[model samples]
Target: MTRFAPYLFSLMLLFVAACGGGSDQQAEEQTADTQAQATEQADDVRTIEMVGIDRMKFVVEGEEEGIKTGEKMGDYVLLESITAEPGEELRIRLTTESTLPASAMAHNFVLLTMNADATAFANAASKARDNEYIPADMEDQIIAHTDLASGGETVEVTFTAPEETGEYEYICSFPGHYSGGMKGILNVEG
Candidate 1:
């Protein structure tokens, strides 16, 4: 119980942060902050849409998954390779198209910051099922992300693109997805 204190506390903070306080003054302040933040994040946003398949793959527009390349899964083509300008806003819309039930197959987008360890983060996230597959301690490592999308459901996340020019990786933090090659890159430039 004691060990769970920090994790629980963090979760509480995240919940409070996500939901505005239950007071007139706090509600008004929260609304103002949210609107301003939304304006900044939605301004000139670049939208990217994708679909999550049960095979742990992201299929882009008009594309189907599991086309045999006769190559290994590592050689499997990238799910999404994006390009964007530094400091710009990017909105990722994810729709899950799995035939499997939601409890068996759901997907979420997790974009890691430059210094975060992808494998380590994914490993931790797999244990955080109750938290939408997001690890509690990894809040600082994530630049932006969307909630888990159950089958046939859609989720979206908007964020300011990193101000640094480089490649950043994004992945599905579902238990086995990232290890199964459900990942991609975001290339940012000034």
Candidate 2:
């Protein structure tokens, strides 16, 4: 019995060590899984359907020209008018159709966070000629944006909606576009 005691002690120690390692591994795996789940959950908030026509109009209100407070082209799709629950996800898709060359006619969708001035954002973007009209200095204010698309081109962007429910604005920073009323709003709600 005495001779076997040492072996028993060794087996117990091994068992405990194995159990501890298993528990640690399980904890790590659980943490990784939780992070992945959180990322997926954040990906399911808002869905913004955007369409840009050669007429410089979005296809939100079922109009063809464009949505703005002006001439009769298309119904102004108010981006701020779109309200979503807090912690929701937002998916934005942009499309542009034009008969002219891409250089002459191109468009993009840029969504800005709350408290950001649309006019300033647009002005800054217009100056960024090399970065496809996206300003480097004001990158922090941008929530999500789509790549510039020429005629017959389309692009999309998906992001988690801001938790604070408020009015978020989006616009086409294509030079004189926003000033021409190429802007919309995204309203988040709790």
Candidate 3:
């Protein structure tokens, strides 16, 4: 009976070890699956790029700006509009080309909520120099925004399109830029 007892103790140890090891294996598999899913989702993001010229215009690649055909792109106007399906992932790139310094002439992209007051927000942002021309009080109204990009520099931001289907306003809250016509409409489809 003593010899059998020793054998039984060894069997118990082996069983305990096996069960503990299975939990670790399952945890590792779950971690790997989560990483793979994140990678796949990142790969599905869509990218859009635009150039912010010295005239305070957003020059969309492969698109014409201004009120007339082949007119030189200028500020105080919407360069182009964006359309997307509800809840889509987007990456917006803003590249600035200006001879002036950052404080003098920098650009950014600010997407606002459906209910946000574009004029009021921009007015508030003008005084928010410390916050990159984005009013802190209106953070909840912002969907996404890129950092200020100076001349010869580029910046980008990634965000999910709003689940609600409607038109949203996007602008550059750089001082009087919004009033100068540096705003556009984002069309989110139902």
Best by lDDT: 3
Count of clashing pairs, candidate 2: 12
Model 2, span 85-127: residue lDDT tens:
6776666677786888977778898879899999999999889
TM match of model 1 to true structure = 0.69
- The local distance difference test score of each candidate is 0.81, 0.74, 0.82
Using Cα atoms with residue i matched to residue i, what is each candidate's TM-score against the true structure?
0.69, 0.66, 0.71
Best by TM-score: 3
Give per-residue CA lDDT, model 1, range 71-171, as digits (tens). 22332333567778888777788998868888789999989998788999999999998898999989899999999999989999989889999988899
For each of the candidates, give the backbone clash count: 0, 12, 3
lDDT tens per residue, model 3, 1-190: 8979989999999998877755777899999989956865769776666778766667664543211122445533335678888998888788888999888999999999999999999999999999999999999999999999999998989899999999889999999888876778878987
Clashes of 1: 0
Q: Single out the weakest 10-residue window by summed lDDT for candidate 2.
A: 62-71
What's the lDDT for candidate 2? 0.74
Q: Give, for candidate 1, the lowest lDDT window spanning 10 residues.
A: 66-75
Q: Please, what's the RMSD in Å of model 3?
A: 11.8
Global local distance difference test of model 3: 0.82
